[model samples]
Target: MGRVGKQTIVFKNPPVISCAYSSVGPKEAAGPLSTYFDHSYEDELLGQDTWEKAESKLIENTIQGLLTRSGKNPTDIEFIFAGDLENQIVASTFGVSSFNIPYFGLYGACSTMGESLCLASMAIGGGMAQTVIAGTSSHYCAAEKQFRYPLEYAGQRTLTQQWTVTGSGYVLVTHGGKGPQVEAITPGKIVDLGISDTFNMGAAMAPAAIDTIVTHLEDTGRRPCDFDAIITGDLGNCGVDIAITLAHKLGYDLKGILNDCGKMIFDNEKQDTHSGGSGCGCSASVFTGYLYKQLLEGKLKRILLVPTGALMSPTSGFQGNTIPGIAHAVSIVMK
Candidate 1:
């Protein structure tokens, strides 16, 4: 592939794989041992105790796992770029404070993971930083209250609804010399499918997925089967179906090949993950905890991870406008 731009940064000793991730979850978590639930506190109120504490605890647990797995001291990290969906980013702030790592905060709803990776790669590619950590987290309770009503409020969710995951996901992207060099970053090309429906995020995000996938294939000159897996962040069940339909329309077959984090993270009967899982933490946790390990184990070679976000604000919802969606793709290859 041709260089996208001037190579301002070069790694003297590209970062190699030391350790990838760590997960903390509720005991007897649904799908994977890596998955966790916050049972520390159970409350029906929005902005209650569990929501507040879970966010910070999720971050703390995630950082601790990363440190323990990598066997690196917190002081070794140069910076931390973390984000969450809570108001004023309270969870991320508290989580980072516990580790005491200097960092930047961000928010992109469900697209946070891709956003963080893009920025981290740039910092490493530009020689601006040697070691940086980027991660995003979301709590089901926190997000629900902020974006919708409290669960106790018993708001009916439609088939197109996406259930939020109560967890956190983090990735340690260091300078190329220290870990796996970022091989390629197909910056997410925003493609609006001209959809509008706050009630059905799955519908909104499907077009964005189609747009990104089509553009990415064109840009890289690769086909759908070229990758071992095509993963979408929070498309859930309905969105996955829509994406598949869209792919077929574009002359691509993604039926059995596509996977959604929301669907994979929990068993339908046991967890009732409902349409599927959303939240910043859903994709983040799955990528770092499940997908990264799969790559290390040789089960997957090249993978396309696309994190989708419904860009409907409260104002937009109030105005009765449909939710606009966006998706960003990060291609990961194991050699």
Candidate 2:
């Protein structure tokens, strides 16, 4: 593990993403990437009594499914890093507790997935761990009740509002695999442009995403075109456009190759997901399900995965505090 620039770290012997799995709800299953997801259930509750429990089950099931796909057991995992949108990250805590692996409950808002991957790569590259699992989850009902209002309220949603995805995704990171390798990571800074509208997450997170992208490119001595694609996690329609425009202003043109997991997970016209998908699961499921598959199939050689997040809690939002944005970039290269 070596520092590249101000916030970037380049792994000497990068960890390989040996296997990945995605489990999504019915709505996401009906979206554009339906065929890419590993599993989908029509029942959002997932046989659980509460939505929170269902989300926990989602993470548990995702991890189990990934292990099953990779032919590994819970005992084989050396460390587990996971998180969710729930307060105190209880979703990930309770979800993986049964596994009894050395756990690290992370909280990066929606960017928890990227943060988990960054740390997992560091642990493996720095010779701290041999095998690790990085995962995240989010639920529409749970997030609605926690962040905004209860599902029973039936409150009006603004046009800028984004639908929280009901899904979970997990990836197994190890060494010596015919899979994509985590080359480097750029940990982002907290950037607040003073946009406080809770419904408009895209506008809030765009600046941070642009900042991380610019810094990563400069640190790695590479341009946007150096990679096959540059993907952003959960930026939705509004944030993707904002980041692109901001990058252009910085003389970095990312017009054709910039893809957003939030936009790709759902069809705006067909799914009626107003702005787009925005949640931890929005990017998590898309990456493990769709993009990782592409990388393994040799469709994409190298790419930058930037997961953006809005650091705002219900208490802070109600107290009239501005939402700060952050984004972490994980550069992956396929062997």
In candidate 1, position 244 carries an lDDT of: 97
User: Per-residue alpha-carbon lDDT of model 1 for 53-79, expressed as tens digits?
Assistant: 777877777777777766778898888
Error of 1 at 222 (Å): 1.4
lDDT of each: 0.71, 0.92
Please report the candidate that would top lDDT against the real structure. Answer: 2
> How much is the lDDT of residue 300 in candidate 2?
94
Candidate 1 segments exceeding 4 Å error: 1-18, 32-48, 176-181
- Model 2, 65-96: lDDT tens digits are 99899999899999999999999999998899
Root-mean-square deviation per candidate: 3.9, 0.9
